[model samples]
Target: MPSVNRLLHPSEAAKRLGVSAKALRLYEQRGLVEPGRTEAGWRAYGQEEMDRAAEIVALRALGLSLAQVKRVLEGDSQGLEPTLAAHQAALEAQLRQLARTVEKVRGLRSDLMQGRAPTVDELMNLQAPLREVRVAFELPWPWGGELFELRDIRSLNYIIGPLGSGKTRLAHSLAEALPNAAMLALERLEDDGVTAAKSRMDSDPILKSRVDEAISWLVEDGANSSDALVVLLAGLEADGPDALVVDMIEQGLDHATQEALIAWLRRRGANARPLFMLTRSCAILDLSAVGPDETIILCPANHSPPMQVAPYPGAPGYEAVATCLASPEVRARTAGVVAWRPSSGRLQSLTP
Candidate 1:
């Protein structure tokens, strides 16, 4: 009798899961997913591994980061109740904000119909009534150097730094400091490699159609080029003379996407000014991906100048921000609304 055929090889497994061999290795490195290994030390994948791999691939395909995937998969599926509860609470807050926003828009529409020009002050007053409902907390501005206000610049700013550098924390503080602003958590986006790979899969007409639909939704959902910039600017204008904080988890964005993002930002900067808090591995702003802008000096928390390089290598400005915000003294000194708190996960406001 013929010997039973073994399950798929690593390469075939990757293909079946719609991921690259490298990604599989990375997943293994993170201990999030594992595959069988042969006595010869070669990687082997069985049906169970394939199923897990498919789940990993699908979660990633839905724009979850590897870290998030780990949390979802290995993180107390039985105890996911707490996370689910947190998410539900957050969603309810967003719903309240959206309801208020709709009312404001309706009032503005009625004013327009009555032939009244909506002044900035009038619009702001309309929004201010809802502000009283939010709790006030303080996050001292990060990097206490000198803030050089650049006026008439575009209404969306993107700041990038490596992980654990404090960008996310700083962004949360900034969002709290700026009234009428909304903070969005950035999801992963497809880079050139993934886009090309997906395009290649178009050889299968059915798969291609599905891929196209996914791409369309990704952009429309505010993860793509035009929509991302557009929504950023629109949010700023609607929020009024304030900043918007985007908590970006930069995962699959490649060089080309970075360049396109920079160019778009520059064009917008020419008109209105906004603040962006981007956290990532490298500074794509200075790269050939887009035209470079002069680095404006922001005041550091200790009155120190913004260093040309990260004071701590690999960490960057985020560290400075984190150090300041995490201080109990600084937290006490902060005035105005503090929307997010990293430690307790308590958010004071319900604005979307």
Candidate 2:
């Protein structure tokens, strides 16, 4: 237990609470927990604040959205059932795995009793590995049919690169190659997609309900309502494909909405399906907030094969990844900027 009078800086508090400082800021933005201000006016968390944050973290771990957490903290249990079910499913999966391990151990003991020695491979097979979601396919256009193979996919993957890089093609190949994966493209932000999304929502009451609930949650966390948000959430319902690839997830969202949407996506916890998002917004991929379950894939400017990048300053391609990400404000300002392929040239030119 921490001392009652002890005060922790935001980073220290986040470390102690096993979360990111960005998460703490989001909690504050949602008015879920209020920390104190030191003489320098920096946010400081006391013991009480730590305890409150711990509660919020536990609720979030159970797959409750921020709005759901707010409601539960306010003494209403309105929306806990679905989240609780999801949490239970995760726990039951673990339980089944444990049972299998127990059976393996029992078989090992039986073999010992029969004076039989276990083989090396048999001994190694006692423990189960995490799910291996892999995709392998020939590279799409721009490259000369290079083989691309990706394995050990994480829950949250970001695909990033500069404007003219083949990142978009790579994302497309991934969407086409991955089993049961679908790409929610930039069309989701277009007027036709918005109208079709609304029509789908109108026809599917369950999808509409989920979207409404998610929108309500985002709205409470400083997001404004727009067709962009509606269509995005509609495409991202829990009942969608096994994996989703999003192209420019922050395409039409404002700063506040982008921030809130990212926070919400992170809070989805175990209920979140694997998402491969091609992002250029800093808010959508905060390097400091990248967690164990997140992976960053970067496409190089020179058209070298896309590679996984470690989320640290000194890693290879880290600078390029950082350069690809622009603040939401910057992204909004440059929304109308377009690059062109000049006439008659095998070699591309950025020289104007």
Candidate 3:
């Protein structure tokens, strides 16, 4: 066994604490952790630092902001009540979902013992919640008038594909087909668009309040206010839309912002309005964060019909979805690099 008093390198310390080395550095920067230094000037985390870092990580896992974490670490409990309440609500929602799944499994097992085999659709239904909304329509251009049927739309649905894969077309079609759904387009970020969005927010006090709360939450997660984000949030929290299809939901937002946005959406629980978000950013489409009330649809590079992809690592089209998504850091590095497509040739030329 390792010595209890032994100090560890940054990577080893982070491993023990179940966090990233970058996160350790962030804590140090925020003055939440103070590590010793080697003679070579490398950071060294001793037992004291490790213990403190563990506390920070626990607070963060509870959705506390870094600032809030700092405050709590300094013995301030004034803000803990609301944060804990939110966490409790989220936990309760998850427990309810789990209970429903357990009941379904029990029923299925009972059927099996009685010499009854469940249908494929019935088996699949046991895995996910019954979708409350669905859309069926003919796919638009690039796809040859193929009928597309999206069943059991979840609270959060991600529409993802590479450039020229017709993901945008799918999103638009979904917006038109879903009852009372509207698409929040990129044009919302154009000049005077922000002003119009702000004007709408001003006209509605409840919406403005919700928007402000969301913005504050995002800021706590390291997001800064931008016209694009504000406009997007305005539409997300807007009244009267049964659902919303958002094109490039991560547009103009940084990695932190995307992470925060997804977390916030997940916490909205099962009753949140359904959202169809088109995204290429890994942060926004995190495979690990896809919940029971979430679904993923991938438009293949070959322009085949879009299909819902199971989020598991080895599921069909899961690799393709993973390939199409990039970390925000990688996205930032390749922001201007676009794949070349010949305008007048057979689409086959663009394949692999």
Q: Give the per-residue lDDT of model 2 (tens digit) for 42-68.
A: 899999999999999888777677778
The candidate 2 region of ten consecutive residues with least summed lDDT is 342-351
After superposition, the stretches of candidate 2 with alpha carbons farther than 4 Å from their true spots are 1-6, 74-78, 100-131, 238-240, 270-272, 339-352
* True lDDT of residue 24, candidate 1: 75
Candidate 1, residues 147-167: lDDT per residue as tens digits? 423232234444443333445
TM-score of each: 0.30, 0.83, 0.70
Instruction: Supply the TM-score for candidate 1.
Output: 0.30
What CA root-mean-square deviation does each model show from the true structure? Answer: 21.6, 4.0, 6.2
Q: Which candidate should be chosen as best, given TM-score against the real structure?
A: 2
* Model 1 lDDT, residue 47, Cα: 71
lDDT of each: 0.47, 0.85, 0.85
TM-score of 3: 0.70
